[model samples]
Target chain A: MDIVIVVADAVRASVGPLGAAYALTAIGLNLHYGYTGLLNFGHVAFLMVGAYGTAVTVDQGGPFWLGILVGVIAAILLGLLFGLPTLRLRVDYLAIVTIAGGEVLRTVIRSGDKDSLTGGVFGITQFATTFFGANPFPEGEYGWGRLAFTERQLWVAVVAWSLVALATILLVLLVRSPWGRVLRSIREDEDAARSLGKNVFAYKLQSLVTGGVIAAFAGMIIAIERQSVHPDTYLPAGTFLAYAVLILGGTASRLGPVLGAVVYWFLFEFTDGFLRGAISAGWIPGASSRRPTSARSE
Target chain B: MPADAVFAAEAVTGSRKPDAILVVNGMHRSFGGLAAVDVGHLEVQRGVITALIGPNGAGKTTLFNLLTGFDRPDGGSSTFDGRPVTGLPPHRIARAGMIRTFQLTKALAKMSVLDNMMLAAPHQRGERIVYAPLRSAWRHQERDVEERAGSLLEKFGLADLRDDYAATLSGGQRKLLEMARVLMAEPKMVLLDEPMAGVNPALVESLLHHVRELRDEGLTVLFVEHDMDVVMGISDWVVCMGEGRVISEGRRRSWPPTKR
Candidate 1:
């Protein structure tokens, strides 16, 4: 293969990892939007918090599991902080608050003042050892030919996909249960659920916390795979990507997010790959530099 | 199983002082310059069907909303089963064993009929935690809940539609489903806002029968209705509201100049 083709092939292999993480994050958005009718535009903030929580903890000498736990807790706390004031408000208010929150969180994490602890513009690194240390697979190339993965990549894929599967199953079971029904009922009509003795606010809070934690888990996986945590990774576009995934997949359907994530990543990769190939072939000149802008627009 | 025996027993227990399942004293609610409700005393008796009837904008639903915590009263004390319930949130008041149905029939449109019933049941203590695995014991509890819900749906002749989404049901069926859902909570009293409104004549008969059945089954029923036939046909006692206050109250036979 040509060098460009070889590089594209390498990137294609990484889509699985990226897709797995997105699937998890999308599932969280699915819970908030599809099931509960919550307009949470700050979902990316949960991802950022998760990634930073894990990176910061691991960088500070915490165990990988501890970092994961801290990430989950931070996500939950962030969810509460965001949900408490806004979830009680109308949908429009929540949407505004959440979108603004995502931006604010990104700015704070990237702030020049917090450079020492957060590594400022340089971002955090050397934090993947904790996660990679737990990998049980022996180091070697895995997968068939063009779709091959190194042992490290395969391990990350396994762990990330496993988390997605577990989250999906748990969500399925929960939505089917009495508790899940309450969430759906609240989504259908909050006053009705309240009349039936369901604390609407509490259920909304729980849904936010659960979904946020899931998003955080996805963020942690992404941070681990990249071996870094940067504020730019948690852009508003990430939230929109999650929303797109949620919509593409039937909302309130258990496998919807995962299916959406897969389709989204596949289409995204195909488009990028085709575009890059066209640029290299001179079919689309100056497309390489513009690709990042188009990708960001998406 | 004989309805007469229960009725006779209730009668022989002379003067059968109406057990106040809920007591609203000095309740007041105002909207801007208009006083919506200003009742001095209103007692919802246990185990009897009571009707709160009034013309449009008479504040019948508003009172229900206030007493049930669906809306806050400007001022008043509400006592439910000897517990001071003033100003409690709707869910808390509901969990205290008093559930209500909406005038518009707020059924869970997206959920299956059975799931709607199950959701009405209070959440178990252990279900709140994330790490708590589904144990066999909880499964058994869930099965019992499902069985109970199924039986209630069957009682209301809705068993065949158990798996169907509630939104797919007709207006009458939605009303029936709302009633059935409330039963899942085993609430002491159910405040139904216009259960007979918008129901077909055939379904109205069934709805009235079920309301009577609910009373016979020892659940207090308070409903708001404009249908005089329904109000007189089923209500043990009728309270009429006009301009936001109880204008008149009497036995069904004695309510007169009854032309709204």
Candidate 2:
């Protein structure tokens, strides 16, 4: 039997793109939850639209840039559609509607009827040519010792992390401005801000659109990195993870989300690695350590 | 001499146009079975200090709310500067040049005193996103706002508290700050509800000076005050309300003045 020790560092390196994707999504969550105080549980719906928009565009022979544009437009449109009716409703209603809306989008895309376009349970594959073609890096593997990545993976990491940094800077500058003060004021007390001549609903809509666009950009990057698309990639679990990252980082602070993203991914990697090692070493009583266990285990 | 003669002469000579700066006609409001206000035909003339006085539960506050667009009336209409203003939102009504202060001094507590004034300024081009970042254009406007706020604060002896949070101010200072914030908007008329309700005597004198100064500066002033001495000393015209309707209307000195 071959013994392959995939420690925390190794696991992190292997799943580097996934962590980056989550980090980007979490940044968007920070904008919604932290700054604006919106409880958006359907953020994953925007992610799904970005992923499917990009995938379907590429599958239909559209250029990668065009796919990215369509994904962004889809995200903005979805944000407006979600925000128009719900933002004016009470906060609790918005939360319920958003969570339900996300679940509906996920189930619809994964349904059997949409299999031809969305690839149903099988998912879509071979959708990365346009993305890889635009890679600025030379075609080769990159990184050191335990953190090696193929040329394509390196490109994805560069794009994903760069987008995260740029978005964070933009958000910091924006939230620091007078406009941002009105937003924070609205978060504190909507009626007070309204009395100050601020259009509260308009500010809420702007926040939703901006945050959704950032999340969709992250989703596009994720689809490009995986070279495929799957409906399961955008689940309630993903939204929950982003929210965890946001809270851990600190809500409404500019660099909190980025810091949160790094800490969350590292912690997740460490816990998963330690659990796997403990289970294999027969330190926990879950599956039998003997060979030829159930086929479901495999 | 009849106080009505003085009021009539002042009304005609000041600006006799039938359209008062603010006119409340047959205004009535009810909260369930309770009638909070039932004012009929109140006119606030331009460039004069008119005081609305009544005992507690006389609907003075409700009348202020209806005039300022904070609450809707169950019946009748309000017109400001000849335009119907009955249904406009409070902010819109404020932007239309009629500003008001609350009895409780509704300052934005979390914001700095200076910020409260800036937010109160009318026609803020910088509120829009495209124009918010324009430093060059807004710098002049921002400076003017700051200067006006600073002058008003200085005039009210609050110059040193510019950077302080409004919530940190004393109750009297909050009342003064609320008055200063309304002045920042350059309103054509001001509706001050209980401007001196809880203010200290020293600040009350300052507030009276400012109210007189507002009239001197050609801004119409209508304030609800229970202090008969203060109302009679500064008010050119007085309208007394009781049980949600006007009981008497006359000049301040001749209306069987009530002692505080």
Best by lDDT: 1
Model 2 C-alpha lDDT per residue in residues A1-298, reported as the tens digit of each score: 1123345363554357766677778878887877677889899888889988888888878887788888999999989988999997768877888889888888877885544778787777778796778888898767665567778888888878888888887777666556666666666556555555566788888888888999998788777777778887887877888888888888887777777777777776565555556677887887655443321121
Q: Estimate each model's TM-score.
A: 0.90, 0.82
Task: Give lDDT tens digits, candidate 1, residues A205-235.
Answer: 9999999999999998888888988888888
CAPRI-style quality class for the chain A–B interface of candidate 1:
medium
Q: What is the lDDT of candidate 1?
A: 0.81
Instruction: Report the C-alpha lDDT of model 2 over B1-260, residue by residue, as the tens digit.
Output: 21233455322212232336787788999888888788767777677788888899889989888877778899999899988999887767777788877777677776778877776666655565566555565667767877887887888788899899888999999888888878887788888888998888988888898888888888888899888899888888877888788766666655664322
lDDT of 1 by residue, B5-27 (tens): 22322221112235567787888
Q: Which candidate is the best by DockQ?
A: 1
- The lDDT per prediction is 0.81, 0.76
The TM-score of candidate 1 is: 0.90
TM-score of chain A of each: 0.91, 0.90
